[model samples]
Target chain A: MNAITARLSSFRRHLDPAVITAFACILLLLFLGSLYSRNFLSPEYLLQQLKVASFLGIIATGMMLVILLGQIDLSLPWVVTVGAMMSSAAAGFGHTGAMLAIPFGIFCGVLIGLVNGFGVAYLRIPSMIITLATNAVAQGLMVVYTGGFSPQDSASPTMRYLATGFIIPSIPNSVLCWIIVGAAAVFLMNRTGFGRSIYGIGNRERAAYLSGINTRRIVLTVFGISGGLAAFGGVLLAGYASKAAQSMGDAYLLPAIAAVVLGGTSILGGRGSYLGTVAGVLLITLLQSILSVMQMPEFGRQIIYGLVIIMMLLLYGRESLSR
Target chain B: MKQWRFWFVEHRGTLMALVIFVVMFLIYASNHPAGFGANMVQTASNKGVLLAFVAMAQSLVVITSGIDLSVGMVFTLTNCLASWLVVGSPAQVILGIIAVLAVGAVCGAINGCVVIYGRLQPIVATIATGAIYYGIALALRPFPGGTVNETIADALTGKLFNFIPASLVAMIAIVFVVWVPFSRSVAGRAAYAVGSSETAAYMSGVPIKRAKFFAYTLSGLLAGTGGLFLTFFTYTGEAAYASGNAYTLFSIASVVLGGVSLMGGKGSAIGAIFGALAFRTIGDLLFVFDFDPLWQPLFQGVVLLLAVSLSAFGLLRVRNRLDWFT
Candidate 1:
């Protein structure tokens, strides 16, 4: 009993205020919506919301890894877009081409992620600046290639299976995919040597290096994983939307970051949990849904979202200060 | 000859920018004969002036080892205000300008207070503020359509003398009046001290919070000026105009390319100005080549990456050379 209590206290220390507030906000919004709106309790609406959240959840999973290393991938949106474009463009070539495109998409993501990781980890350049540049490059490339139009064909059967198809009648295949991915992520983050090494590096790179960890390699690997995951999310997105547009990934960027931050992950790096990030994703999706249901204007929604993030951050910042 | 060599050694980045500019100009001239004259020059110069101001604003915050992601959003807000208020009489136009600057200053002051008093990191705090500012702009003008006085626009777009553009003149005047003092004054030196080592600066009696507040306020003022210029150039102010979504990256790129250290405490105002000019010139060259507009963002990103890499390389070389001399 004492051991369990100690463990709980340790967990509490790691809990970010933003994550807690976000969770509460999600619950409050859902309760309010269910009370006010007639269709809020429907299985179809709930399932649809889950389906949307899955895409963000998958991306945020990889984003969690990157953030754990104290680095960010600003190029995520474009990479996701490029992946969708590649997937759709390859669809016309049949099954083999589609299969080939999956790796190709992942490869593209890895390339950009490697560039970002190398610049930040090795060259000691700021990650934000490098990722920002790469984002521009990636978006530009997508526009040049696609001309801002949706691509020609639907996603392949396998991709669609990952997106829209389901294990059960009511549950979305995407949500199932999210569950599998989330379980694997939780295990990897909690039980693996790599996970511990990531935390060590994130907390203090010099100290980690001194302790004989290959910090640089770990950083590169984490970014590569982030890239691959983002690309995978792109595949799911193509399946859901049934078309790959040029700016399809733009909307996901903020939510992915927000999910990671709101999941109790420190923006300054180190100390976070995948489970918390999962909760964070659900919370954000619910908040968006509630706002949309409330028929709020775009500007008002933005204002509320900004205020929530700021207030949460302020609370977290003050807590850390007090500590 | 020794003195000249020393000057070259000290200002290698500036010299490199000049060489690149010449090479790009030649490429554009050779490719598009019609674009080689005053028209191209004026447009490039005007873009450079606008970007230079933004770069300067970014540089001020960067010197304190912080960043202002809200610069572009603030620019949009001021632009909108200017458009809405300047449409009346000239007195209204002047008052409008004051109001816009005041609004900008207040926004920046809020950022400063949050960072200093509220103890928020500059990056996170500015990002949130950026969203708020963008939201306010959207609220003010949900869609695209606002008007500025044609006379004011003409004055901005027109030339001062026969050869020089009034916008360029305004830029130069701003540099002389604002940039010089901010970069050379006691407060400016204090800013450097704070950025270099905040604890040390505090121990030495420097008002770190005050210096930071000044930096943010000045950044806001410059952003306001940049927004006014943007309105003049574009002749309209929509909510989406000058959105922070893209300029956040561009301003940082310009500063980095200008040889400003991301870690802070080592760069010049002149370097930042030239950096903006070089960046604008590159874009103009691309336009002259008729590269697809869709690829522009990608090109900007690639160039930004290359610029950052090159800056790092330059720093390495400088460090090596210093070690050898020592």
Candidate 2:
């Protein structure tokens, strides 16, 4: 009996309790959703949810990287909008524009991210404020570009195929994109020097700099990469919806932050995993779906969402945040 | 001369914000078709005061080395509540105003409790609370239609006897009534101490938790005032998600431009007020310049980026690279 108890303790030691809790919540949410509707447990619906989650999953991936570096990108909403709007806008030029739409949108996002990094790293400004300013700028630029009207250009065929098509007979293309991105993120965070540097900088930038890490450059690059991923998410969103719309990204900002935090990524930075973020993404998507299925009013859903996040934070995240 | 220099250094941020606003306002006035008449000033003040109150609310929390994302939501929530209650007879309207402010205080207290007692980060805690506040706001006025007492609205939003904006007067009075007293109080000093260094402050037996709680509570009251004024401005209530978010962001910008360091323990609400006025002027400048209103956001962004970047110049003076993090 003692041997079994010791083995259990060892197993618990290897796992993050927050991640486990998040996964458990996801299951609990699934169960709750099934109680609301029998079809909730069905394969097609679950796959559909996964496809939908991939959008947030992608954006949250970028957010996680920034958060790991102990910086935030409040400019995310507009970055996503810029990506979708610019990519779709590019479709107006011709076949080449359509072909380059995806890359173009992602490029626009990366530009914004690089700017965020520059402001945070080189300028030594707080990440929150810099990202906020950039977000306003992006919003302004988009407003001017679209003339306050919704852009007329629709997603290209390739964009559509990438977003909603079945690339592997049964699996979604977007899910596959998420898998590819997630795999890369896992490898980057767990297996790369860059990842270690991010953690190091997040832990203590002064120490990282003293140790010869080019902290500013790493910051800029992480922000840039985060932007690219967010824009890529936008491209997928524009494709799924068939057109880019103004303020489409507005709905995403809090959710992405909440998902990352919920997944046990420290809001203070330096300690989180890609797998935890993945779990967080699914949990948020599921919670979102369940609330909607329960026919809860939008405001009610928001209240519940906020309350739950706070409750969870109180439960587990209270201690790690102080440092 | 040394004494004078110290005085200048102390007020540098506030004076800079004042100068920026003055210069921008002058430019805006000179180019205006109306040429800066009482009516125009009244209009500008009415618009500017809303942000000023919110900025002041933000500055309080920031001075305590914390951020409150819910001020805008509190502003919205109060606006919605005011629409419902700040109507009918004078007695009823007064009661309604009190209730609105009280609710705002409650919201802020909740934020304080979460951050201080619950041991959560201010940013995340406020964001969550902000969501909840916004949800309540949306629930309060699901539709964008409600009524505020027209008499009170007109009186507050309009100019006093043709020259001074009443909204401006109210703001000043509150600054004197609320800010002066708070800044001189032990709690306020504790807030500064905590912001500068929580550990040191605690070791010195400063009232760290109480100071933060005070800052958060007062912040809510200020935001509530902004919301109450919003109802006065529009004479209607709307649960606008974007506008709420925008106000929150703009308040932060105003705080920064006012020279209140996000790093905490510096700057003043007076500077933040001037910063807000200047920020508002940025939007108005485009109008006088004949630029499309569409250009406002882009123009605002460029100006803010430049302004924030100017503060980064100090980094060049650092001899040790490690000092940048601290």
Candidate 3:
């Protein structure tokens, strides 16, 4: 009995209140949304929202890892753009390019991520400034590459299949991709030594280093992962839209960040779970769906989105501080 | 030799920024079709002061080891408000100016409260508030069609006595009125203390909260000044989303270039103002050189990267590896 009780208590201790609250909010939002629109609660409508959210989930997963390290990656905007643009540009090059499109797009993201990581880890610049600079550089590069014209290529069949097609009828390929990524993230955080080190470093970098962790390598690796994931998300977006447009990735940066923070992850790092981020992604997606259903203007949706983030920060941010 | 080296070490960032700005400006002027005449200088100053004011605002919060991403939005919001308010009779214009400035201060105060009392991270808090402010601005001027008092606009944006730029005079006056007094005050010192080490400042009985509040509020006021100037230059209010975000990002670049530490408790607004000027000069340099306008972002990013990397040299000099984290 004592052993069983102990196991139960441990499980309860592991449960994050923020994630629970977020789940509750999701349920409430769904209920409210259904009342507003009869179609909102249907399985088909819900599945579609989940698919849309999968892209953000993928990006936010990378963002979460960086945020867990007490760093940020603002370059996601341009990185996503680069991923989409490059993949499309490559697709126009024929069979080899089409075959290599996805990898090449992801590679673009990883390269930029490498630059971002190098600056933050080796050069000792703040990630915010460095990433912002990289974003500008990426923007400039893309503009020059495109010669201020619309990108000339469409999404390849492989990308279109990955982004828009499904192996199972009703279950999205993108959601399956998210599940794979999400599962890996969970396994990384809960099971792997690297995940433990991420928490340790986030909690206290000096201590983590003194304890003999390769802090710099971990930072670079996470940044690379983040860059790659953001790019992957961008490629999916291009596939969904049929082609990449100029500044196509600008819309995701804030929403990705908002989703991460909403998941009850401490912005200061070292604490948070993928489950929380998952819930955050769902909540934001649902809120967005409802807003769109209500026909709210873009600016109004922006205001509400900003307010929700602030409200969440005030509530959960204080709890973390008190603890 | 040691004293001279110490002084040089302390002022190196600012001096470097100054030299870069001078060289770039000189190159721009020499290459310009209009030459370095009063008209040319006035035009440059008019364009430069908007960012200079915003950068100064950013410097205040940055000095407190906090960042105000909302400065750009506040600038835009105030610009929109000024277009609606800064018109008609002199008395009405004066009232309008005060109201606009007050709104900015209030915005800063809201940020301060959320960050300090609410114990939220400054970056996230400011981003939220920035979005809100931008939303308000967008709502205020959905299509960007509102006018400021033309007389006030011309007087501020135009030159003084056909030689010196009136905008330059206004910039200097604002520095005297705002930056000089704030930097000299006890609260300002407390702000620096808090930034350098908050626990140490608190233990030492520094009014950390008040200092931070003042810093953030003043930051808002400076941004408000920028917004007013933006109105003066454009003669209309626009709530351009891209422009606001660009300003926020560039202000950070300027702050870094100006020798202010992002970690806080170091550098000066004067440095940041020059940083802003230098950054603007870099943009104009491209124009004068006839480089493709598309190349500007790339060049700016490279310059920013190089400037930021300059400060990293000190990290290499530290004897203990642990010092790197600090």
Candidate 4:
């Protein structure tokens, strides 16, 4: 009996409470939603929801990494915009631009991430301030690029295909993109030395350095990856929307952070899982859908999101305190 | 000489910020088409006070080593609430003012409860509360149409003695009424202690939680004051998401520029007020230079980044790298 109890406790340790809570919320939302609309339970409806979740999921993945490093990237909004704008603008060029469009967009994201990394890692600036400044700079650049008018370019065929296409019957191409990105994140975090170092740095930068982790380099690399991922999320969004618009990335910043925090990742860093973030993304997407179905106003949705975050923080804070 | 150097070093950040603000304002005034006239000064003061009030609110929490991202939202919510309440009659207006302040205090108290008792990180906790406050503001002023008592609005926002700006005077009154007493109080010292080092503060038998709570509550009140001023200036209430976000970001910039360390336990609201004024001047500078309005955000951002980066220079002088983390 003692052995059995120990095993169960071990299993519990493996299962994060935040993830469990998020899953339960998702299920509850789905059940409650279905009661209101019969179509809520339909495969098509859920699949569409999954596709939407994928965009947030991808952004949240990068957010989770930054959070794990005891840092944050507030530049997600502009970085995503850069990705979409660069790709779409490239598409307006000849075939070469079309071919290079996606890469160029991603490259913009990577470059921003590198800049973020440089500031945080070398200049030793706080990621929060650095990212915020970078975000402003990006906004300024984009504003100049668009020349205060609407972007004239539209999504390329490949971009549109990636956003709207389906791979395994019913599963969206965007979800496929998310899966690939998510898998890579999980592998990097779980299977590689780099992943462990992130946790170490998050847990304690000085200690991580003492342990020979090259803390600065890891911080730089992680920020870069985060930038790249945020940009990638933007690319998918543009594809889905069929074009890039001004300030298109604005909506994602809070939600991405919300998803990361909801997924059970510690805002203080050094502890969390991608699995929890996935659950968080799905839960938020479902909650949003349910709110829409209920014909709730945008303000109501914002209130609900805010209340839910505070409630979750309270819950998480309590358990840690008790221990 | 050593004592003088010590004093200079202690006040260096604040002094530097003050010097920067003075220089920027001088340059801005020199470039202005109308020069430093009463009209221009009044307008600038009116614009600066909005951010100044918010930055002052931010400084309270910042002093306690916590941040209040919700201050801007509180300002917005109170502005919306004021537009509705500050209209009816003289007595009604007085009541409206009290109610707006009360609402601000209550919002700050809520943030206090979450961060102190709930033990949540200030950033996330305030972000959540900020959103909630913004939601409330949106609900109150969905279409952005309301009226403030024009008499009161004019009295507060307009020039005093037909020479000095009434807004600047009111700002000074608030400084004396709110900031002076708070900084001199035990609770204020406790906040400073907590900001410098929480464990050390606790060990010193400071009422750490109480200090933090008061900091947050006062922050809300100041933000609410800002909101009331907004109503006075605009004579209407509009729950603008972008504006609220901008204020939040700019408040941080102002705080940093004012010589208040983001690390906490340093700087003064006076410095922050100057910082806000300087920041407002940057936009004016652009206008006077005939730059495209679109370039405002970009220029402001670049200037902010450069200003903030200056603070990082101290990191290089630290002998122990571990000091960087702290």
Candidate 5:
């Protein structure tokens, strides 16, 4: 009893309870998964899983920034699609186009993000509605750009190389990309004034304003980063598939939100850690892998996914509500 | 004169929606080759009423300052269920309709219980439940093939007379049946009170839980009505995930267009119905003017942004920057 008490105290001092719980869930899932399939815990399989998780991790990091501000960007689906489609379309041109493909895709996302920021920060439209409207507009434009048909444009060689290629032996470039982004996110959230301002604004806009933070600019920059990250994730997806399909980003929205929340980040904002989000990304990716390994049908998978999220929310969100 | 102004203030949202719908429909009808004929009206009503029902469902929850993202999934689930149950003999059809509606209420009640009793935020709770409901729907109709009773479907969908669409009359009847009674009931008034100010409402001895439960259950029933009509119009049940999401989204837009406040405690379902009508007219307006069908989503988004901006102009009037926090 003494040991347990001491351990929990140290744990509380060093790590968030929600983060610990999530890591515990990840470990528990692994133990159970290995019991079901002997190869589930194998290093090769785990490494492969990390490679897949990189995509969602990239997007979730961006989502985290916005969620930390107590705002949401529902426009992720179309922004992602726009990124993939536009980048691929750009790559359809000559050598110059191929070179600029990646940045161009991300830039498209930034543009939408700015619009989202303008609506939310300046216009004071609720983030949910403004993002939703932009999502629709993006979707429509993409459809018209491709004339409601699947694009003939395929991902460039450089794009393909970035996703499937590895610089160091045994580590995927995609994972490296995720690490770079995650590190940047950590630094921003911990070391930067902008990141601190996000927490302040999220806690209470009036308080933050009184404290002299430029809340609107922060909102715009955060949304812009989110858009760029979503597009980057899309670029990775395009590379993996070697092309983009219609509405490919549709499947990412809920999972991204679920991952961020699962990581113990408050959906209402103002409280969370980047490491928690990382754990969340890993947990979600692993659960999905294990479920698919079990051959659970799509509908069944969906049901379990929803149930798990609710269970997690019930565990943590209850405290926030009561206060 | 003072009483009249007060009444107008109370009904302004609905009135605004009515005017918007009137103007849009007029433009659509004038531009159409069919020239606002009975056939044209029937076709328009058939499409418009589905959204109207969903928007009404949304309005019920929005009035209480809670959102039900699962409303669309309830719609899809009930539609899938209706396809399985709303076929066969007359007795079976009635039973099936009741079952579908019951399931919708159950789904909604689950959402309410999570939000109210479990103390989960409404947005996350409904998103979670929405996924579950959608999963059930997918399991029921994996391939999107189910049948509905053609006779009953035709009666509901067809024209009441040579000049009047049956769907429009039924929508009005539903307005009388659902919205009127709820707005008059104690629970309904409690809902409004809670929405306006929950802490104050609770202090005043309003039955907050009961009011919420009533609102959520009715919201489900209304969405179920939409599902039933969907089965009628399509005459088949397919678990179209995109369509469910679209309906959920569009209903919110319609609610906003109808002058229903996303902030809660304001607006009327009557206005949401017209809002639905106006939103539907966007597509028709495009078709009448020979724009590509692909342009529809962009057009809808632009119009919505403009409307939302018009509303946001209210923010400009605030001299105190802190008021923006509210």
Candidate 6:
């Protein structure tokens, strides 16, 4: 009993402003959704929300890792779009092509991530500026290549199964995939040497380097991982939607960053948890769901989203000061 | 010769950007001599003047180790406000201009307060405020339609002196005004000091909060001025007008390309002005080449990357040479 209490105390102590606010947001959203629409409480609606949240959650997981490394990857939306496009195009080539497409998509993501890592880590440029530039490059290339159209195709049985098919007749395969990725990410972040090294480098690069850690390698690998995960999410999204559009990635940019920041991960790097990020993903999706159900205009929804993010940051900043 | 070399070294980044601009123009002129003449010059100059002001606004905050992601949004807000408020009379139009500047300043002050007093990160705070400002702009002009007086627009857009473009003259005048305070005042020096080392500056008795507040307020004022110029150029107001993605990229790119460090400290108003011109010239050159609009963002990305990389290389060289001399 005493041990359990102590464990709980430790967990409570670790609770950051992002986590608290995300929780409050989640509860508030659930409450508001229920009040506004009875359908929101139904299992079907909740499951749908979870399914959508899973897509963002998976990408946010990678975003959290990159942020944890004291860097950012703004090219995520385009990377995701590329992944979706590749997968859709591959599906058009038949089953063999579909099988090949998953790896190919992941490869594209890894390549871009590597370029970003190289520019930021080796070149020692600011990540924000570098990633912003790269994102533009990727998005521009996508626009030129796609000409502002969605690829018309459907995934193969395997891809479709991962996207729309169910694991337990009610739970979505996408949700399952999210759970597996989330669990693996949590374990990798908490119990792995690589994770410790990431935190170390994020906290103090010189100290980490002196301690014999290959800081550059760690940074590169984290970005690579982030890219791969984002690609996987895109593949899943394509399977679910049955088509991929040019600007599909634009919507993910803010949410991916929002999840990481709302999960209590410091944007400056090195201090956050994957579990918290997962919660944040759920919270944001819920908030959006509630707002949509309330029949708010698109602009109004965006305004509220921005305001909530600001409020969360303000609350977090105040808490940090008091501490 | 020594003085010339010293000037070149001090202004190398601006010089490089200018060279690039000239080379691009020459290439364009060679290909399409007819279109690249006075008409193109007028359009490009007008565009450059507007962006120069926006870039200057961004640089003011950036020099203090902060960024104003809301500048584009603030421009949109003021543009819409100008259209709505300037309809009554010429006096009202003047009042509208003052009101726009005041609103911009207040918006910037809010950012300053949140960042300094609330101790929030500048990027995150501005991003949030950007959303709010954009929302307000959208609410003001929901479907993108407003008008300015035709006479006022023509006068503002037309040449002032016989040979000189009014827009160019206005840009030059604004540059001079900004330069006086930034290059010749203690407050301006304090901005550099705070950006270079905030903690050290604070310890040395610089009122860090005041400096930060003033930087943001100046940034807002510049953004408002940019909006006013946009009205003169376009003669119409739309909520979504001038809120292009290119605005954000070009604003940052112009400053960085002109030798202003992203890490803060060590920049000039002249450099930012040149950077804006270079950016506008690049766009004109691309359009002359008949490059697809879809590729614009990609080109911008490459240009920004190259510019920043070149600037970083320059800084590195300076450091190495200093080390060698020491």
Per DockQ, the best of the predicted structures is: 2
TM-scores of the candidates in the order shown: 0.91, 0.97, 0.97, 0.97, 0.97, 0.92
Task: Provide the TM-score of chain A alone for each candidate, in the order shown.
Answer: 0.90, 0.95, 0.96, 0.95, 0.95, 0.93
**Higher-DockQ candidate among 4 and 6?**
4
In model 1, which runs have C-alpha deviations exceeding 4 angstroms?
A: A1-18, A38-44, A318-323, B1-32, B241-243, B290-298, B312-326
* Candidate 4's TM-score on the B chain: 0.97
The DockQ for candidate 5, computed on C-alphas, is: 0.65
Candidates' DockQ values? 0.48, 0.67, 0.62, 0.59, 0.65, 0.46
Question: Candidate 1, residues A24-143: lDDT per residue as tens digits?
Answer: 767777788889886887888888998989999999998899888877788788888877877777776976877776667667778878877777766667777787777778777777
Q: Model 6: residues >4 Å from true position, as ranges?
A: A1-6, A152-160, A318-323, B1-11, B241-244, B290-295, B311-326
- Local distance difference test scores for all models: 0.78, 0.91, 0.90, 0.88, 0.90, 0.77
> Which prediction has more favorable lDDT, 1 or 3?
3
lDDT tens digits by residue: candidate 5, B1-326: 99999999999999999999999999999999878799999999999999999999999999999888888888998999999999999999999988988888888788888888888778788888999989899999999798999999999999886778888888899889888999999999999998999889988999999999989888998999899899999998888889998998888889999998887899989988988999999756889998888887788888877877777888879999999987
Model 6 whole-model lDDT (C-alpha atoms): 0.77
Candidate 4 colliding pairs: none
* Candidate 4 residue lDDT tens string, B1-326: 99999988877767887888789889888888988899998998999999999999998888887888888899999999998999888999999999999999999999999988888889888999988999999999999889999998999988888899999999999999999999889999899999999889888899998899899999999999999999999999999988888888888888888888777899888878888888888756899888998897788878877876776788879998777776
Query: What is the C-alpha RMSD, rounded to one decimal, of candidate 6?
Result: 3.3
Instruction: Give per-residue lDDT, candidate 3, residue A196.
Output: 98
lDDT by residue for model 3 (B21-111), tens: 8998999999998887999999999989999999999999999999998999999999999989999999999999999999988888988
Taking the tens digit of each residue's C-alpha lDDT, what string does model 3 give over A97-122? 99999999999999999999988888
Reference-based lDDT, residue B224, model 5: 91
lDDT tens per residue, model 5, A53-137: 9999999999999999999999999888888888999999999999999999999999999999989998898898889889988
For model 3 the interface RMSD, in Å, equals 1.9
Error of 5 at B315 (Å): 2.0
Which portions of model 5 show Cα errors greater than 4 Å?
A: A1-11, A319-323
